[model samples]
Target: MALLVLVLSAIPRPAHAEIAAWMVFEVGSGEVIDQHEAFRRWYPASLTKLMTAYVAFSAIKQGRITLKSPVMVSAHAAAQPPSKMGLKAGSTLSLDAALKVMLVKSANDISVAVAETIGGSQAGFADVMNKTARELGMRDTHFVNPHGLPASNHYSSVHDMALLSRALLRDFPQYKRLYGYTGVQYGKRLLRSANREYLRRVRGANGLKTGYVCNSGYNVAVSATRGGRTMVAIVFGAASGLERAAKASALIEKGFDGGGVFKSHPKLDNLKRPGSVKGLPPDGYCRRNAKPKLEKLMADYAGSAPMRAANSGLPGVRTAFARESGRTRAAGIATSRADTTIPRTRDKKVDWGVVMDRLIGAQRRSDNLVRITLAIDPNAKRAVPLSAPSADDASKNVADAFGIVMPPRGKPDSRPATQPADTNTNAVPVIVTVPTRASDGTPTPRPAPR
Candidate 1:
């Protein structure tokens, strides 16, 4: 970034380079400090889920669905794409589980399953998505597909992305923690987050999805909060993943450059509550349908502890660097990354083949379904160090695997299989732990399985 900053500063005048698009703003207040080609059109890739989740949250609030609402997978929905929850057509997820799947993996099929279950089909839910966007002042955005896979007419501007971020904070503040999912596990399988920063050691950084498509380059919408102050930043189309994070850090610093909203509220403690847990809701269809006991408390904090005491400091948003020895100073920040010098080439065009390897917690051929709740200590990163469940009592292991119980009693269609199961725990590991940033400050690129 210092080199880029120096390069930008050295530019005698603004050059017409396709620099990445980005912006940063205070959530509650509509303050835009730094901006580039924020209005430029770009492909959202998976970031489209932010809108989908927003509408789902709205439905939950409206009593149309519950966290426990059951959404059954349909053959059509199951056929969509990988990055899926891999449930069969007959399987059902509580509304909550469905949300989790979508939030966590940016699963495409689960998005459709939730849409169909809630609105009766994809077209119906899309109506809600577009209308909601209009109301949120996302004038330059449109949703053609529930999952943000390629669609002919789908497009959005970075400016619009910032607008959606603002709405998420203002309207659905209760579910903000949903944005912070680094990785999650279901029973034995490990599902990692695609957001590298969260998987790494960056603190205060929660989430907003990361995305890429050949035409879109790379896009990431990230929000980080410390104390009571929260800032939302968006970076679209970057040359490299490391560059994206660095650029985002700059935008965020610029946003904090002016002043914070919590300046007057000295006692306001910052709290990030349990947001919609990913995978579970969107795939499991077990989101809150009816407000439960202690709903207010649940509303206040979704999952994590709150932060108290605020820090007062400003981080500058620097783009092109200015050499101390040189007389040059960066004029306006450089906008696109499509400079002639930095070649625009992808390592390999993404081949969306066998995208569902992680689905079914590792695909297995059997009529029986295994459920397990593998307790994970957040501080404990390695796989659960426990005696083998299978080597012990088979029935108890089955019970533990499916700890919550099968179709138990809720839905008449819910049926548990008497068929015997494989004893292997068959651990399917998908979550990729991004190496913590070395103190020397160099990014070690760990390729996330596409």
Candidate 2:
């Protein structure tokens, strides 16, 4: 018999148990409005950047680093992976710009640069982070790196993270502006932050960070103000980014509605840490096989309007390679969209040979279709607009439309590579051969071209 059980464990199967941890606090009154497994250790992921920012803030306050100071991308700093700024080694930006890239882009490499600039090296900066965490009453936290990449020994809990966020707000109220930005502009490109739920949709939400890795699932520390009261909400081990934001938003609404215990919680330092600890490995919780469980949970606890709003862009948020790019590359044709059809000029069906020459001359790797502006005549004031069929639609049935068989693998070249037309083209002629059959029904190969 097959027994199916759905456990919300942040860890994998046979452990059919809840894996999530969370906390909601009232900043003005120091109340633990709500909490769940808040003391358990979990990987902080890029939420580790919060403490990294805090250390930087402390350094800024103490004159160790200033917003205008030079932030150089070192060989070490430039090596951290995406999500990053893609800064090359030896590149530099002001402390202000680096901070924006780190906070808004959640860039891993810039985080390293900030750590190195202020703490003198990544190791030294981590030392500063731990010391700062202790001072801020985050006893359950440890920092092995400035960016929250996977490390066996590095970890934090919801309580500790919430505490660090409070410290950032209270001690450096001036830098509070950094947390709420929707996106950071880098030249012509807009690098959007993953914290869109709080910044764009959630009412009165402001300031904080979001984080993720397969190991961490999703984590966020968020703060919002309503009717003159501000609240901090921390969520960990969520199955997806939207779920994390939705849960955090729900806690914010609940805190404002006076949900959870109103008893005054201990100061951040006095909050007890679990004696023995191990960070939950997210492989079991975040893998592809867990989608059904994730969907059910999303439908259940995450049914709020704001939560639904957060989930609107569910799961299609990464790079996708162009389809024809893949096919042509594999076909050993040039890795570009190429068309040889020429534009008509002066109401004349222009010479195909002449047009093919000009169209091929104008082909570029970045273009999805061929474009030609025909003067109609050399001295005509207005030009005729003509464009080739889009390569984006290259997936049509070649046999039905072009009547061309896909040449078998390991076969000789089908056509000249330079003059290859899109397989989906209707105007181009494609030759297809029907093998001659013997009268007994055995197939016969066509005669080779002379």
Candidate 3:
């Protein structure tokens, strides 16, 4: 029996048997509230973008580049794989706009463009990333590329990522807004962020980044603030996006509720650990052959009731509609214009008048502006207007239509605000606009009414 037990113990177990790496750190006190397998090295994937952003911020601070600096796309950048901006070789955008595209869209091509622009070449940029990582005491981290594409030398630990997250918050506070954007309007295209959904669902959640690749699994470095206290959570090697988010949320919630305080937890910077180990490939746990193992992992990290309650809801329709209203105003569209832009079908243009009549009829029956808009042209950028109202008024109309209750100005909710019954009926209709394609298939905005 002893000989058999010794042989079994020496055999390798399935990846699911190992706990995923995770850590919760309190920003104010620098306390590591909790942690598991934090020192184990894992592929950073696009989490490498965080370091890329860091290097850019540092360059800006040192007067090497300005936000207005132009980042020109090169043939190399344009050739990068998907999760990219698809800009042509000679295309250029301001660094400010490029950063938004890279961070929120997680565009691999933009990452390389920014790298080449700032560091003279992709290889040089890798040096800068590594140097910065060392200065920040990211002991187990390495960078072989700016985009975190699969490379043998590209890896980091959850512990290192938490350290980097703290550095971002502490060093360049002004750029915090870059991490929280739900979506960025890049010309006629609106690029949305997966992190946006988490921001809407989590209470007090704000800025951070997320990453995924088959080798890394789903990874996220998320932070939330409540009552002046902030917590940062790092999760790695989850089987899916939902699991990754759920684990991060649970860790942050646990930190905020004094789970890390009662006991003596080590300060984040001072936590000692053994030497790093090679990260295990997540294929077994993340692929089709691992349903039972995935189920077990989910059960192990399943969130608490409070977390479930917090994340439960239709995504904030009020926020989405408000963003659309803001976009309309930015485009200088007139409130009095009755006509809305309609999308073109394969060979024919959609008739705006007929679409409006159908939408108005549907609105009368269902009061759902979104549903009505989708029925007309699912890809239309702006919401279908029933009547022209000021942006604020239009947003209120959308909120009422979606049964969402907007909080009074200057009063934000600590949790996802409980929406009450919709009572407003006089919803003003807003104009919707769709981009028209040029001869070369480039999208151009419809002109505002004179």
- How well is each residue in 1-450 modelled by candidate 1, as lDDT tens digits? 899999988866422223357777777556666666666666777788888888878877776666665665655566676788766544566666677777766778888777766655566667778888898777668888777777657878777788787778778888876666665566667565566443232335667777755455567888767667677889876544444554565555545654455443211112111233111111111111221222222232211111110112323542432212223334234343211111112344321111111000111122212232322233422211112223223232223322223223334443457755445677664432333332333233221242
Model 3: residue 306 alpha-carbon error in angstroms? 3.0
Cα shift from native, residue 397, model 3 (Å) = 52
Model 1 sits at a Cα RMSD from the real structure of 21.6
Ranking 2 against 3 by TM-score, winner: 3
User: Quick one: how many clashes does candidate 3 have?
Assistant: 3
Candidate 2: which stretches are off by over 4 Å? Answer: 1-19, 260-279, 282-285, 292-299, 302-450
Model 1 segments more than 4 A misplaced: 1-18, 259-450
Worst 10 residues of 1 by lDDT: 353-362
Residue 21 in model 1: shift from native, Å? 1.1
lDDT ranking from best candidate downward: 3, 2, 1
Candidate 3 weakest ten by summed lDDT: 365-374
In model 1, how large is the Cα lDDT of residue 283? 16
lDDT of candidate 2 over 263-338, digit per residue (tens): 4555444555567655565454455323224334434433243322222233643221111311312212221232
> Which is the better candidate, 2 or 3, if ranked by lDDT?
3
List ranges where model 3 is wrong by over 4 Å: 1-19, 275-450
